[model samples]
Target: MVDSTLPLFDEMPPAGQVAAFKAAFDAWLAEQRGSGSLRQDGSVAVYEDMWEAFAAWCLSQSPVVTLSSLDLADLQAFQSARFGRKSSDLSLTPRYALRLMRLIDRVLRHHASRTEAVANPAAADWIAANPEIRYADAAHADPLPEYLSVSEARQLIAFLSSARPRPGKSRDAQAPLTWQEVRNRASVGLQLGAGLTPGDVRALTLDSPVSQGSRVRERPWKLQVPGNGNSPARETPVAPWAAELLQHWLVVRTEAGIAGTFLFPSTRTGKQWQKPSQYECAKRVLEEAGADSREGGSFRLRHTFALRQLRRGTSPQQVAGWLGIEPSKMKRYERVLPGVIEVV
Candidate 1:
């Protein structure tokens, strides 16, 4: 029998039934809290707060209510009252409404699983109907990369290799090369030219191979190296421009006498640099070089490398092996990169 005294619902039950239900519900909630199923602290506080707000809104409808006693119609009415109606200042979109409804349903199902009575099927049906509510298409908004054109790539290399164009005044010689400035430029080449991830760049140690050659090899930190999903180990090649920057950085590093195992050490800590440090350095370099920060970061450089390979008519299987992604994933990049996708 249902309890009428429960403010949320009109049905009333005997005192014994109400006492037994309350005891079981409290015991079940305690179990969930102990099992780490119902989050009360940490990052889950925000979610807890949101659920409590929904509960408060439901309770505002009537004072004599309990969660277990609430039916689908009452819950739906609460949802409609809070989210369906629009105010002058702001209105809840279908997406936001779905988000809250999902959370509410999740808690309700969890609670129902602990009890004898089954949860309402109508709420479940409503959830099934509102699946895949996307607020925006972020994928289409991503812009094309502003990479170094083939001609520009060659020009930049020549500029770096060449001496003064006209032998200007002493002003040129007096310019100070801040350690950070040099590292930033090297970051671009290492990522764009070498196809190294930001983590790979950070984990670089002084002992890393920097010999004068196009085929310089270095094993980045284990974390930075890509796992073959479930396969054996493999080696990825270094790009020519990546090799050039690496070669130049080696000369500067040797002169500085920086003795840490880490190729990039934090000036403050004298410790090997981490991923965030390397990312910031790379961002500065890309911004300075007028490259789009969104498109020319380490991942974009890797994308460019894969795209170039695909454009050259390399098979998807071969490109997949090089990029350490599944073959099907490689096809997406090929299709996305302009000029690489050729429909037969």
Candidate 2:
């Protein structure tokens, strides 16, 4: 018993559909405001502005965009248009991008909950499918610091120590103990053994690794980490194991004709290596030593260094000085210490 004059919602005109969506959106916002779900602040204005931009973009698309028609691809395209397509060209950082995506997801989920006909395309499963979005979500999440266990550290050190130097003209770049391998070994060793940050590693000069005359080979090496705007200059002792690797690198670096003041320099120019290259070098070493390389980068190694020192009865203040960070920041590490429970 279909009425001949009944209105077809599915075949509604693009303009009408957009108007309907706007009306539904306004109603949702009002309900959220009334329920105190949305605070009376600048955040509400930001949400409104983002929605306006999204709606305008939807209207501009061919065949028109309806609330029900929105999908992951459409959301991704909107993100690409608002932010830049490439990571380098991105106007917003990962955290901000994550906030934007979350806003859209929330609004859509609210709309879907009220309308049985509509489905939320930005569900957790769908969002997890996009690596960029997933990474952004993770970047915004609160998590424990990534570090190595005592056993893992021992295994990594053993591997680095056993890796023999292959010094010859016909040596493969991929082989162990080549110029690059020795350099990477020393770089990672600084992070694990001396608690050097990636920036600290880059800032080191040829004379940075100071050793006492005559006892240079017998005693532990001292490193001079230069200060920047954030931290002050500090001298820290390097572990004997790591110092040995660094000494080996000095010889290889000279023989390989890497002429520069910088300790870890680009092979061709002997100038400071780019940040990405430095990170990759550390990551490669971690992978070779069978350590986790997915998160934390060199910072994990630094964390491992901090935890190791703390476990050995080193005071937080002293460790903080070595790390070039405030002592209060060490509280996080203290809370994670084995057999220690934070009251607060």
Candidate 2 colliding pairs: none
User: Against the unseen true structure, what C-alpha lDDT does each candidate score?
Assistant: 0.52, 0.72
Estimated TM-score for each candidate: 0.46, 0.58
Candidate 2 stretches greater than 4 Å from native: 1-94, 97-143, 164-176, 218-220, 340-344
lDDT of 2 by residue, 1-344 (tens): 99978667544347686786687668778888999998877878877776777788777776676677776566656766876456674435765666666666676777777776555654342343333455665643434566776677887887775543434534344354678887888888888889988778888888788877526663448798888555678988788788877877787788888887898996646778755567657767888889855456557778888888887788999999989989987887876787432210
Task: Give the candidate number with the greatest lDDT.
Answer: 2
lDDT of 2 at 193: 89
Per-candidate count of clashing residue pairs (backbone under 3 Å): 14, 0
List per-candidate RMSD values in Å.
19.0, 13.0
